[model samples]
Target: MSDSTKQVTEHEVINYLKEHPEFFINNPGLLQQLTIGNPQGDVVSLADRKMLQLQTKNQQLAKQMKQLIANAQRSEGLMDRLFQLLTDLSMNAPKGEFVSALVGFIQKDFASDYFKLYLGDIKLSDDEVCVHYHSAQLKTLFASFNNNDAPLAGRLPAVKLKALFGDESAAQSAIVLPIGAKAAHGLLAFGSKDDQKFHPDHASDVLQKLAQILAVFFDSQAVNDGQQSQS
Candidate 1:
């Protein structure tokens, strides 16, 4: 017989084993009888290697499960707060009333050190929380968002902090959510004293959801205002 005919390829063995998964149970002695070589040049019985592989896989799965649990627990409180905020804002509120309610929630439930909101050109005077929408600054800072309702989270330098909040000592870390569809309606910025409070890696689905709703709310109002003006 030729060498090729005599040789039992690994693929054939794998296919055979897969086709008959009960092969191991039927030939139990092969578990100890067969030996495989590892990359470390160690020869271990098939049974030992299988057990080691299973243990490693189990450890990896356990670690993944723990991380999933941690993320879920962290999001639970934020979800509750977001739900409450939505409930409060659903009272056919005017823009000024909406801003007040949101600022209150941010200070109390969201634990933000400082927060600012900028909507379209309105009659209200400029303040820390409600500011005139400087289109140029927003365009510069959030060019990456491409003028969409996306949230930006990370630490900001003194230069950026000074430009946005008019105070270099405004915040160490911050989250900014752009509120708009195509043209920007405005933005909401939350600042924190803690340097590690906000980060790019931190998943903030709740805030993104709120920003989308705010964009829709503002767009609908603008449409209604235009209709009333025409009438």
Candidate 2:
């Protein structure tokens, strides 16, 4: 036969084997004789290669399952802590006491190096926990915060870090969350001494929820203050 005819016949044999998968089961000796070439220029029995592939896949699946379980446990713990914080805030602490309690919980429970709440034009007697800034100042400082409600986490610029924290601040990383939907109120900033503590890829769902809860507290305080002034 011609070389072309031999090539066509070889291809037809492969196609036929694929179509009749049971053919190998009937001919056990043929399977034992089949060898496949490996990337390392070694030859292994086809059956052995297939078994190795299955073992690798099973190992990968086990690793993935373990990671998923660990993530779920961490998430449950965080949820429990968040619920406790909400309960504590609901006890109707006075304005100064509330600010103190909030800052203490954030610093101790959340392990934040520095935490500050900035309120635009909203006056607070506890200047240590809260800061008052003009609308123009906020716009100028946080120009990159396009989505006001979204949390921003990463290494902050030196100028921005100095503006938020004082000139003496030694924070390496930070997370900033807008307090209100319209961002008319202000922002909540959390700083960390560890540079890798906060990154752009970090998940912010929990932080955003916490910011929303704080917004409710601020709004309630504003309403109460308005009522007291009218009385």
lDDT by candidate, in order shown: 0.73, 0.74
Point out where model 2 deviates above 4 Å: 1-71, 121-139, 144-147, 228-231
- Candidate 1 local lDDT, 1-231, one digit each (tens): 998689898999999999999998998987899999999999999989999999999999999899888778867876787677878675356876665666566566555776777666444644534455646777676666674445778887776666666665558888888777543777777778888988988666766776676787777778878998999
Model 2, span 61-149: residue lDDT tens? 99989977876786678778878867766635565566566666566556678777776644466445444453566657786565555
Whole-model lDDT, model 2: 0.74
Error of 2 at 41 (Å): 16
Per-model TM-score on C-alpha atoms: 0.59, 0.59
Report the lDDT of model 2 for residue 14: 92
What is the lDDT, from 0 to 100, of the residue 203 in candidate 2?
A: 62
Model 1 residue runs over 4 Å out of place are: 1-74, 77-81, 88-92, 125-132, 147-149
Worst 10 residues of 2 by lDDT: 126-135
